[model samples]
Target chain A: MSRALLEVHGISVVFGGLRAVDDVSFEIHDREILGLLGPNGAGKTTCFNAISGVYPPTLGDILLDGARTNGAPPHGMARLGVGRTFQIVRPFSGLSVRENVIVALGGPRYRGNLLRSLTSWRKKGIADEAGAILDRVGLLDVADRTSGQLPIGSLRRVEIARALALSPRLLLLDESFSGLRSTEIAQIEELIRSIREDGVSVLLIEHNMKVAMGLSDRVVVLDHGRKLAEGKPSEVASNQAVIEAYLGRGERGNVA
Target chain B: MDYFATVATLIVIQAIAACGLNVIVGYAGQISLGHAAFFGIGAYASAMLTTKAGLTFWQALPAALLITMLLGFLLGLPSLRVREDFLAITTIGINFIVEAVFIYTPFFGGALGIGGIPRVVVMGGRLGNNQFLALCLVFLVLSLALCRQFARAWAGLACFAVREDETAASSMGISPVRAKLSAFVLGTGMAGLAGTLYAHYARFISAGDFGFPVSISIMSMVVLGGMGTLFGPLLGAMIIGILPEIFRPLIDYRMFIYSVLLLLMIRFQPGGLLGDSSLVVGLLKSLKKLVKPKNIANPREIGGDGDV
Candidate 1:
């Protein structure tokens, strides 16, 4: 495997008295798809939040390409090539889908510059580039549609497309497959594979086991804010600790 | 014709100010109830500079804008931490404090206000009211064009994104502070410019002219006009500014009627006059249905209108 693109070492997140994520560590290599799997309240989203800089870790280090970035703001993280999607999709609802992508495209580079923002219209090929990105995510048809009116499936694609606009090295998707139908999941799974092929590493928090296991190169399981197991999909899925935590003690014996 | 020109002048001035406030409150989603304070600052700054500092009207205009923008940046600093309701309260406090200073401080002429301000001297001659009205119209045109450029630019997009969701905006690499500050500066600066014009045109000013009520009226113009739309504030200013002349008999109940109108607007049409979801659209749709039931029944016709 290539040198780690993202490394979370001994990270812990505490909210009030509760330790939402405790002493979690993981590595995501270049051009890799790593699945972060856990049941509800198992710290999956919390871990994604910490890595994406939404919630800074209370303990340990987050290294992106070997630079320590524990408490960098989310925009700073984006500049460092970290992109994320919300669990509940956040589309700039008032804007057109294309405008939403354009905002993300210009964000890390052109923010706070009145002159650049003004001349951004004449910038060569921005619209075409935004259009190409929308096409890649299969949202070209709805490029001009108001983002607020888009259905959940299209909104999910918009979120991913917006993330892709960052040209991120590491994409943290919080439940990208959640609430998606099996057919839609298959389509997004294909898109994720294509993204990996394009050299973007992905760290996905997924609840859909079939899609997660099928798509991930490797898997890490979290149980009650702690790492339960980690390995290849088959190995991690067969781990007794993971089965017990996910299936409960009474139903553990029936795990496939 | 004279009366018409005077009313047009007021509308144009109010529209310029409303456009400025629209950036802060309408686009950036920051509530500022004290915009009139910046307007006063411009007026007073121009008055003080022209009379006290011995500068020309044109020179004082830019100077007043610069001063107001500096003040806006200072005001925007506290906004980096506070948001929404708290920010609104802070601005209201600023308005009251500035008004108090203008009313009580002898330097600002206390209740008597500033007077003897010279008329706008255009091309080495004092401009008549009509010519002055033309100047305001030119400024209004320029401001509207600048605002349109802003709305079409990435800066405006960033503001909209921040207003919608700060966290999402940040994740996309847009800084909320920078976006909000830009909006605040631009908005307040425009208000200051309007104040400069108001001072030179009115040729007499008092703190009463730019008190809390003026701020409320300005905000109402933006709200009633359409918060983020390019023509919304202009439309709103015209309606608010002219309504008084049209209903001169009930002039005493003017503010009361406006308050009730605002209440109705918020309850039924929060988007305001030119907002996408404005009551005007609803009324148009109903009127369309009344005119041509066939068009109302045809989804394709609705789609065609949307395309347009």
Candidate 2:
């Protein structure tokens, strides 16, 4: 893949009188972890949604590996190696741990459909690949159990596993750390390092400033659907606009 | 004795049919009210092949399966974009369209219906009613096992995840629309199997038999059984399938009691019987039983109650 796996340029989304995300442009370099940060309603999610194809921009383009993938659906993007995890982890609750990954691992890129896949099993090493994916997710232990029975933290990891099984070039994590205990958050942080270390470009949106600041190679801050600051975490953390956005006009110094 | 055996067999057959419906309604949380249409398609496919081709019943069975599967896949097209009430409307519409086709088409015998359906014979000779019933029971067991497997398998889990949260499931690379449609097609295909069996066993078929009431009855079975459990559909089908017959002495009042029972079941147990029995619930219940309760309640554990 190219060094810049995804180049999201000039993207904009408007809601009546409000601009949810305006002229947001960012490049996700290959094998790097970038963080998007904003307070509640900062258009961080709207921007993520646009990139993920949940919301096609009211304006502008997104290039996946230098090809315009602007209006592609999630399935198409997934097929092209763009995988994502939800802020609220969605493990097909009724499904066992393995099937969650199986769909992504068995998409058009892998097993495809029923008839073709029936033959794929006999071809060579397909079962081993599926087993490998389950093992990678740490879900191999609960591979037989219903994913729904899991607590929120484990479901979050399942979401990551299912995404990873897609064999993505770019992984977008939406609040991957939200709602987890510190120990659970630590496990995810470690997993994120390993995943980024494996050459997948990651765009993570997080409200937990410490986690975002700690892990991000670079952090971008937004306010009222507009980019307020984008730079190294230390620099963005100290920026006047970002400080104002987080702490309001006169309280910027107090925030530190 | 014959009546008992037949009821038992019919209960198993309908239970299998209801199990398919339950996959869509119960596990995936989509309501499919036109399931009878799939059943009808299967029945017609089997009937046509046996009569027109002079094929043995066994030979016709697979043809019936394939045709109904095609019908199911086609009927499933509308579900690719809709769910809940809209999906129900589409299925209901398909049922009526298929029913109209059945009642009017010269090929399907119009209102005169089709007959002379050769009895299903498993071992070269015509199966006695009891022997035929055993085969149906075997199919029922296979169907039930298939349902349970899918319900708990990745396919079933995707349905539940989508049912619980569409956005989250999609983010995990599972398109909700695609997952639901697959479930709908598979569920309808099973309904076709049920219809094929019914046609051969009954030796005659009519459009009027596979109508809206039957669809409602199937939905009633899934809801009555519990929306997302292995035993729910079976239990739901048996109760709905046999209760009216049991109360036949009440004449027209049999249906009235059945309706009241359905209403009470929904109100008292919204998730159906097996709905509340989640793993967490089972574990917690067991844990609670093992511990003695103390009277002191902590007020500080409240979360977000004060937020307006």
Candidate 3:
């Protein structure tokens, strides 16, 4: 097995009196595709938030390449090579599709120094880089269109393109398949496979069981803020606890 | 000609300041209701340095700009903790506090403003009204170029990203706090530049000159011209700055008409006159259609408008 790229060591996130994620732990090896599955409100996104540095976990540590990085700011996490897509897609709506990707492409360089950013004449290089990423995600055709006017499928691709611009070692995709047509879903799955082939690890939160099962090498199921099952896709699908957590105990007794 | 030149000079100066404000309000998506405070600071800094410290106008200009920018940085620090309406309210408070400081501080002349500000001496003689207008025109051009550069550069893109979605921007490796701070510092520094020019040109200064009303007027220029676009604020300043002089015959009703016009603009064209969906764009599009050949089709139309 490849060395672990990310290790979530018993993290808990509390919101007021509610423990959104409680003592949940998992690991993703380098070049691995790990599916994070849960029912609605099962703390999957909360876990993503914690790992991506949106908020610090109330307890435990998140090690990225063996370095403790629990409470770093989101941009700091991105600088550390952690890219992410939101559940509801966010594109710089007023900007062109190419410009949205360009913003992400130039983020790290321009975020710190104002004078260098203002005087820099790297427009041609950045535009070429953005075009390459957009072409990778098959959005090169409508690269000049305003992002706000794009449909759901294209918007999702834009989000992915923006994330890819970060050159992340770990990609966190939150519900990228939701609201996409089957054809789009297949295209996205192909893209994810290619991303893994490029040696980038992926942590995907997916509700489409078949796609998730086929795509991920390992699957971790979360039920009520706890890790219910973590193993190979086939093994976790057949686990009795996971079945009960999904279908409830009264209906699926002894079925697996 | 003299009246026209003076009005034009004031319009150009206001436009420079409005362009600065647009960097914050239009591009970066932050509100600053206390911009006049920075302007006042610049004016007073230049005034005190030249009058009391016996420094040349050239020497004081850079000092005033740096002082205003440093204060702008301090002002931007609090913006990270507050957002939107709260940020607007905090800026309003800053305006009031700064005004109080100006009115009460002994060094700032305590309500009786400093006077006898030295004029820009080119070679041997002081600049005339016409020459001064020419100088202001040059600054206006520089301000516009600066704004254009910012809009196209990496920092500008970061500002737009932060404006669109802060969380999404951060996840993409852009720091929201830094983006906001840069906007604030640049915007306030521009306002200070305008203030410096105003003090020297008018050869007088006062707290009432940089009051809340002046702040509102600058904001209205940006909003009326179209907030985010390059030429919008300039157009806004020209119209707003000249309207009072145009309506001088009915001076009492001038403000009423101005208020009515702004109300109508907000109601009918919230995007301002130069925004993407503004009337100007619509008119230009129709004009293009009218001038185009009837037989030839637009390539973009053949491509089905680039929609899904």
Candidate 4:
């Protein structure tokens, strides 16, 4: 595999008295699809929050392309080519759907001077690029619609479009298809495949093992804030520790 | 030439001012109780230039705008991560500081206030401020149109997104701070421009002229008119502006009557005059079934308006 695009080493987050993520480490390669699997409260989302800079990690080193960016703000991360989507799909409700993608693409983080002379020209270019990305994900139809008015499925896709606009080497999608329908999930899975095809490494945190297995190149299992297992989809699926944690093994079930 | 022209012109000016405030307070979901401070800044910027620096009212207006925009951008820094009561307090504090500067500063005319401010003239025709008032209307229209366009643009989208959810917005690569800052700056600059126009036309200025009452009035116009809609600010300003004028005959009881009216309006009509266009659309769609009765029943069934 190529040199690690994202190297998260010895990351830990302490909240009050609880060690939310204790000594977590992982690597994602260029053009790779890394699946993160863990039960509710298993620290999957918290780890995502740390990597995406939503809340900085209390401890550890996060190197994106060999540059340490542990505690930098999320916009700083975006400027450094780290793009992300929220698990809850928080879109700007007052803005049109296309505008959401445009905002992501044509933000101050990447765009030129605020009072540039040829802003219209730049805006047109940005709009074209944003439109193409949205069209790729079949979200062009809702381009002019206000984001708050979109259904759940469209909002998830809008989040993906926004992330893609960043043109990031590392993209993290937090349960991108959590509340999506069967067809919507399949559409997103295909989009994920296309994103990987574009040489963007994606770390997807998903509860849907079936979808994760279908879309992810490799799976890493976490249980109770610890790395339970990691391997190819089938291998990770067959792992005893994962099965015990997810399905509650014979003695464990009886104990419960 | 006539009082009708003056009042109508001022209404248009205030309406434009309210529209500017709407972008920040309405669409951006920020509560700026210090909007008038910006107005005061604009007035002073223009008054200082036109009276002391020997610049034309037109020239000083833009100058005032540029300075006010810089100050607004600086002030918006606190809103980067602050929320709720803290945000409100910081903004109110900014108002007080700016107001204090105007009140205590000798050049701001201190207690006596700035007078003999020149009437603005353009093209040497000497229509003076009435003509400049026309120009202000033009600026107002331009601002409103631009704001409406932005309301439909990614900039507007960024504002609403941050307002609705900050964390999720940041995750989507939308910087909430940047969006909110832009909104705040745009809103304040427009307010300042309005104040400058008022100063130039009225030929007088005072720190007390732009204070809490003005800020409250601007905010109420936005809320009572409708928070996010383009037309809401102007509509709200017109109603609030005229209501006070009409209640002038009530003499000593005018303010009391105004307060009761405002209270009743707030208590009964929080959504203002224009609430939800979509909800209204839905209601109309349901009502339309009684007429057409054809097999068309989904409002979101279409792709979208596509107006941009």
Q: Which candidate ranks first by DockQ, i.e. highest?
A: 1
Write the residue-wise lDDT of candidate 2 on B5-69 in tens digits: 77877777788788888877877788788888888888888988898788888898888888888
lDDT of each: 0.90, 0.79, 0.90, 0.80
Candidate order, TM-score descending: 3, 1, 4, 2
Q: Against the hidden true structure, what lDDT does model 3 obtain?
A: 0.90
Candidate with best TM-score: 3
lDDT string for model 1 (B89-175, tens) is: 899999999999999999999999999888889799999889999999999999998888888888888899988888899899887
Which digits, one per residue and each the tens of the lDDT, describe model 3 over residues B1-308? 99888898889888988998999999999988888888888898999888889887889999999999999899779864589999998988888888889899988998998898999877778899999999989988999999899988988888889999999999989889988888889999999999888888788898899998788888888889998899999999999998888878877886677678789889888888998689988999889889984757767778786794
State the fraction of real interface contacts model 2 keeps: 0.34
User: Residue-wise lDDT of candidate 1 within A1-256, one digit each (tens)?
Assistant: 9999999999999999999999999999999999999989999999988888887999989999999998888888987888899999999999899989998887645655658876554355777889999999999999999999999999999999999999999998888887888898889999999999999999998888998999999999999999999999999988888988887876455554
DockQ of candidate 3 compared with the true complex: 0.67
Q: Residue B101 in candidate 1 has what lDDT?
A: 96
Estimate the lDDT of model 1.
0.90
TM (chain A), candidate 3: 0.96
Q: List the residue pairs that clash in candidate 3.
A: none
Clash total of candidate 1: 0
* Residue B282 accuracy (lDDT) in model 3: 97
Model 4 alpha-carbon miss at residue A9, Å: 0.7
Q: Identify the superior model by TM-score, candidate 1 or candidate 4.
A: 1
